[model samples]
Target chain A: MTNCAKPSANCAKRLVNSMSVSNDAKPGVNSYSLRDIDAVLSAFEEGRLTPAQAFSLFREMGPQFEAPPGQGQDAESSNASRLREALNELDSLIGLHSVKRLVREILAFVQIQKKRARQQLATEHLVLHMIFKGNPGTGKTTVARIMGKIFRETGVLERGHLIEVERADLVGEYIGHTAQKTREQIRKALGGILFIDEAYSLARGGEKDFGKEAIDTLVKSMEDYRDRFILILAGYSEEMNYFIQTNPGIRSRFPIHIDFPDYLPDELIQIAELMLKKREYKLDPWARNHLYTILTKHASNLDHNAGNARFVRNIIERAIRRQAVRLVDKENPTREELMLIRREDIGEGL
Target chain B: MRRCIVLGKPNAGKTLFVLHFAEFLHAKEVTIKFQEPVAAPRKGTGVDPEARTGSAACSLDPVSGSDPGAHGRNPGAGFGPSTSEHFKTYKIQDAVRDLTGPRPHTTRCLQSVVLELPAGKGKKTVELIDTSGLTDGIHQDAEIRRAMSQTLSSVRAAHIILHIIDASKAGKKGAVEAMGDVDYQVAAFAQMRGGYCILANKIDLPGARDGVKKIRDEFPGHIVIPISALYKEGFKEVKAFVLREL
Candidate 1:
């Protein structure tokens, strides 16, 4: 019967109801988080908690108390910021403009589906299984990793970590071994994403091979654990197209097909520079010019389907080694001298 | 299962409205489940002395919503425990006559009945509960006080709160059914919950029109359905609201 439980009547007589305007239009059942409020009021009535004690228990029942703790320091705002933070990482990647747009669309679609579910409206089935078609290093794995983070932030997935495997991991050497290996990979990928790199190779041996068993296993697991994990098939675009065409069942299953287009030479240069900056190194003017020449000629000189990022990583890493060898004999290299990579660092021609 | 609770001050037609609402949902008989107030154990947070410091005004944050584990708790920590539960099946008309009365605080314990609502393709079951009245100040009778506390606890856990206010007695400045601090507290506490709505009852009585308008004007932005609990006038809107929320 203390004043804390019963406030002055006149104080909030004209208070405007902000419930309708708050919580990002979700203004639904999430607003009044349960049981804790009941527990407190009853405790107060039972005299276990003082009026003052009950009042503050009610106060500590803040907005994000419902959000699972330990993941976010400040749950309410940080969950939202994490989504943006994940998206910003997506945007910072060089090229893949269409991938970025499509990612945003997928995010919007996922968010709308959740809202529709909240409202009891008919939400479209969340079939997020996707086919990522691109040559190696067209940011396929990078985008997949980012997608997992974005999905986690949106509450779509639990762990959001990536388990990457290729054909050898799924299609084993002998008979029943393929299914066991595939199942093990699927088990490891249950909460997050199962990224199958060079996915088309599983379909390479045709109907008579053990690869067919692996495909059947993957498709069965996708159905067996729908909504539990997201399956991403990534490889050379043409081979992926042929793979989907032959296995007619796979096409309908993965509704989203994102084609990772090859980065233009200029775009490749930008990617290389970004990579250099991340490695705490800078390209001298001569070295930048040398990189531009090598990448521009890379189309005719190198294997067409080799991962673009992989090739750049190869060149950058090799250059770092060559630069180390060149500066080894120096009396004492300045910070700038150590940081810079000269044209001589580049392996000539190849 | 969404729990839609009917609550208000004593003699505000809460019991009648609940029975009428049950009938409105096409129930011929209602098996009412009676539950007494039981203390739920507080977990996840340690007891702190600072709980006495903050303002008591309603902050609609869901408390301990993260405890999916608490879904399965020690027996009585959920609802009814220790006390023997009484399940009485009464025809809709018998319930109206037997449960409701003109005297204040007639309905003491928590009484709830499950009614099915037509939602899209399949039907959904919503529990409609009627409870004892909440008063402005502490009452001398410990039984009534405990019942009021039970009603408050039910209101906290309910998915939808249908606060039944008597329109006929609303206009007078100082009447038994006059809006008081308890009403304001309930309104503010339920403000953040989307399933909260007001039902202005006794619309069949004279002077009830003014009461409905006054109720609407006083609590702006709230959906107030004017209904004669005896006549079941605004039962359609109530059903639609329930359907949408459930």
Candidate 2:
């Protein structure tokens, strides 16, 4: 037999109103029948009604359910853990000492601004459009990607994904078309960072080219979106400087310019070791020395586009493949032999 | 409108093919409808398809009279109630010259143009949609990913799928491979559906002949047409395919 009360007008409202007054069940619910209570309870249990709906129904039947506290605290802690993980990932990256420091500063600034907003204080505008000047294969793209994730974790962006486009993605062939092309990319990058690689190429096509139109569209979008999205233009140092010099408006729009220097030979070696460590591979003493000697040679012969982490990656990957091939013919190879990259495995060229 | 979607990786000449194909059909004015991802009032991920802003009407002057066989076949095509009358016409030369570029990912959002091809005593109206490029692996940009997903959904709804591959760049290192994993997946998925064709674009460039062989090798059972989209080289076959499918 169910314990529901008899039906009456305003019975649901009265039961809900009496929830804060008493913890006793059926104190105000005298109208509903036992069968009605059973049906409603089963509906709630079957997921037909939401918690709030079920609670309201229970209250109307003169039963009170108190939700325990600490749920907010649990959510906050989980968010903090995610943020910690993202920052730790950023810290684990090799080199880019200055880049890490800049990211810390930005995070602190954003945090302070958020705190100020809660106190009803006027906060400083955070315009994070930046210029990243470096050689090819540097950590511009990598760091930008990390920063996007960090920003998303910290609530600075709705979605912290990185959209990487080159000049070809931005510039259209004819007049009025460049704006459409650039705007489309911008629209896609609304809640994230628009990392334009080789951005200087937008200015390379000379006068009457649609590159200028693309630039104009980009600037307009930057102004329009403001803090909603971060735009990071990356390119080689000299060409990027020339690009900004020709387009004076760009320098003012991008207040943060970070110059990524080439990694030293030792730093490159550290990066190489880190890469190898990630793959659970080891280098023999002879192979390590050979790798160092090759690095030294490449460092000496560095061109404008040299000093690349990507080059190191290629070398390591090739060495791993070579090592596999080397051990393939060996009968009953030991575990140590399988894990090691020998001197011959390290290729001659970078 | 019966939708024919042009899809591929970036720099695959999808946009060029769309405009040149429009020219092939002798469309005077092309109204391009841009389907942007705008948030809905009730649901967060709800995409209201009929936002209908920023649509451009391009006038198509210098209509091609070159195809004697395809010309004057149908007189009253694409004027039915099914055809949308709101599009702007563009000149054929102006549209071709402006629409085609040496860029990747030029068309980001879904841009649909209603074009009519002459058929037996009438015309068939088809909505030719140009979409953003889809790259293999995960894209870092949330916007690009969203657009790509949207493009995929659009692909499922489209009647005809024209998959464009840059024939010139197919075999080149760091270029769009002749048959990338994503390409293979899309091709295989489209196999279950109707009217899917691969357009081996940019045959005017060097190494495209090899690209053709590579494409044929990768997509063994599919129809692959080799053409220079810039010169309208293999548009006749494409038109025939569209006609047969539509």
Candidate 3:
């Protein structure tokens, strides 16, 4: 067949005129030709259509004799690739299995609902409201970040992000001021998870306390954004209970409770070793046992201080210093020698 | 039932003291119930202009019921309705209801406890009112100030006042400094023409001995007792003193 391709200057001018006409149309004008093309292109970009399917659809639509040139394609592809990279990074960092399972299940459910929406099938709305109650340094913040990623993966969120706040951020000094501060924090955390650490501190003072205003505002926002936003309140067990019970309004909404128990003695030892390994240091069996013993003793003595990774970190630093001081003229001791930490290195009465 | 108010500053162990007092009263075989605020629809009508507003002008109805203390005098009449009112009205009804309902002729005398312990005593039903602490940090707030003022006005109603101090921080430089700061508020309550007792809490701590001494030296006339609320130390002495004096 003879090629019919030809440079038509009049056609190019008509294409530009058509582009301007489409751009200048009234907001609600039914420009079916341009609208259909845009819809098909968006569907393809969103991965609803494969390249072959898009090509077939493009052919079916037929080439417009007066179509204008489009803008850059590289920027859009790079953005999609960047989002994929972020999700992969998050997936690798979060290690808790149960937390991961919960997040994946939520994401899968959301995807199912999205597919159902496209099919116009009857599907119930899914609401993922969760409360994380645990002691400090137990990966509450990390879990929140993973949840953001999971939401983004499920298409519930366009860009997964997390915002963490404390009692000081929400509370105010004067009456009627705490509500404004709490509302501002909610706005900052609008499209993502809002994490409130030490939330129990909000209930410290009596009725006249301004913290009550923050609580009221938080409860109202939670109701207002039940679909889009997730609020995670965390603190000591007893204090969190008091915080929830202090206001009858808050007690009802937050029902899903996930408790993170203190890490076992062995778990703490393993964690310490992991931390040391990250720093390119090896722990001898004796040193590991010594660290475990100290952690166990401390855990037994105090109701708190359990699963406190910080305590282990401090002990590791002390042990490292002792080892450094005890080593004589040995230049870069062997791995075994470097790993071997004696009782003296742990110090007395640890 | 006798109602007594526990008034102190922040960190003065008011909440802890109230918890212990409730436990103590429960151990004494007294059936204690916490009364929540009564929800009543607001009345649209205004008070009658002819209604008596003066305290002295108000007359006590001379109806001789089983409650011997009912018509004596309403010490809390002038003060407006507060959270304490729930406890007060509940105690009154709880005390007198058994006497009037079904067991009328059984000589079942009802003893109501008010945080403001009235001067005269019949059947003693004690109510403990845990007032907000009157410390320097909290004294600046208008609401706290008003609550403290209202609490002080009703202080005379209690047969005994327990002044709780933080023994652990007693003799430190900041502790000693804060003592002088709260001296005015303390003097206002201590100088009141009413019975008062001092409690040096946190005795389990190392410096509690010196703290007790400091309090004893500062407020000489009032009775000072060293205690540890957390450890439940010297609580028996406190209970004995309350029973003996009030």
Candidate 4:
């Protein structure tokens, strides 16, 4: 083989693995197929082939090269499997029990409707317009993104990406500009999800405000697109409830309402650990206790929005920075010195 | 539909690439939407006779609101009534020849053509937008300036950005000469976003191989796809990138 094909030990390892998989498969299978793909990829990386050639080669390999079980069956089932993988990912998240259950319910409801449609039975329309009431950084946006992917996987949406916007993005200056701006956003979110953060603000600035115009435009788009796109209006629980109650039209339109409660202290700690683990760092016992104590104090402070996952994320990130600062001068730091976040680095309260 | 907006300096073969890429994707007929910038709403605002002589004026029926046929006499210089929206449906061949030429700033507005690519199981429709060329300094022409701002807005909204650079220019000299300050600024801004790729165009030209090499060196860590946009030689990669992104 050319040196280009074996650029790194990683490539050689994948080749060995592919050779094993090829051997395990029935005879007559192309044993060199995976290696061929790696070779072409490396060649393209080295500027030996144009993108057109690489793409055609990739397309040719799509059918002939068999991926190991659970990797991906084929292109046809990839979308569905991708959706399943996303759900698995959601389930793997630290907390949000109620959120997971609600997602499962939506999936089951959609699947049943699909079956009913196939059987010629009368099926109810799936109006997925949702109101997500939560404090800041409570995984509302995160869940909405995953929901977009899930909806796409379940055939509810065509393009399951998320278009996140705020009141400023929707409400424009001038008389007719707000509607134009709002409609532009709606048009962009057509085949996916329109996530309106701080959505209650759309009802603020009085009845004559351009926010009202944006709300009107949004309502019209909801009716026009109907099932074409999913609109998720997210905000604080109390404000969102008030906003919905005042606007009778909004209350009647959004059928699904999900409330994200603040994460408990233990959950926050779990989240911190996960975040630290992801970055190849670990919280020592002393730092772990410090984090738990800080989280408990903050959660008990009744500031509801005091510290959630975002707060944990900030503290962990800060600790990582502090750790780096503490060790940057060392000639050769040990593995533990590099990976550990100590108690002193926790700093004072937020 | 996801939007893949094409942006670059003037005469970077953006129009040719859009037309040819659409054709390569098997578009029988394309519905082109020309979103004329709201700037310069007045009639006959910046028409200059000096720039009107080189190109031939071929009159077709007005495709949209109020007759814009008044400028048919001086087609090159007087793009009259460009503030109003227009739609043109054309076959690939006619579009390729008519939309692309040697002149700079041929596309003065946001012109988008919708094309579909067959994804794994289904087809994905994306609007491939062609915009006015960007310059390093502020352009003196009001129409070009308006279109430049329009292109910038489209850049912000686009999920996938294909930054087309003239490889022939870069090949002969260094990237600093071939690319402009605006090109670097645009690339720098787009670097933070995902689905941004640099297309080194005019690879069929004599010096383009070196230009592609220079582009790769200049914009390290960017996905650079080299192609002769005129011949649609590297469309498969563009297609794959768009499909993966969308």
Ranking by DockQ: 1, 4, 2, 3
Off by over 4 Å in 4: A1-73, B1-246
**What's the lDDT for all of these models?**
0.73, 0.69, 0.54, 0.73
Worst 10 residues of 1 chain B by lDDT: B56-65
Candidate 4 per-residue lDDT, tens place, A1-350, comes to 12333233344344434443544564443345433544443333223332223333433343232222333435558976898899998997878899999999999999897677555578888899999998997899999999988988876787888999999999999999999999999899988999999999998988689999999999998988786788999999999999998999998899999989888888888899999889999999998998888888887787865547898899988998888999999989999899999998888745
- Once superposed on the true structure, which residue ranges of model 1 sit more than 4 Å away at CA? A1-74, A114-122, A172-177, A206-208, A305-307, B1-184, B192-246
Classify candidate 3 by CAPRI docking class. Answer: incorrect
User: What is each model's TM-score for chain A?
Assistant: 0.80, 0.80, 0.69, 0.79
Candidate 1 TM-score versus the reference = 0.59
DockQ of each: 0.09, 0.01, 0.00, 0.02
lDDT agreement of model 1 with the native: 0.73
Decide which is better by DockQ, 1 or 2: 1
Question: For residues A1-350, could you state the per-residue lDDT of candidate 3 as single tens digits?
Answer: 10113212233223323443554455443334333443333322222232223223333344332111232425436655764765575565424456556666665676676567445578665555567777776677777886776565444554457888998899888887799899999888866778888888888888788887787798888778766577888887778877777667676777567676667777777777777777777776676676777778878986476776666777778877888888866787887777666667877423
Ranking by lDDT: 4, 1, 2, 3
- Kindly report the docking quality category of candidate 4: incorrect
lDDT of 1 by residue, A26-101 (tens): 4443334222464445344433333223323333453222211122335538878999999999999988999999
- Reference contacts recovered by each candidate, as fractions? 0.08, 0.00, 0.00, 0.00
Instruction: Give the clash total for candidate 4.
Output: 0
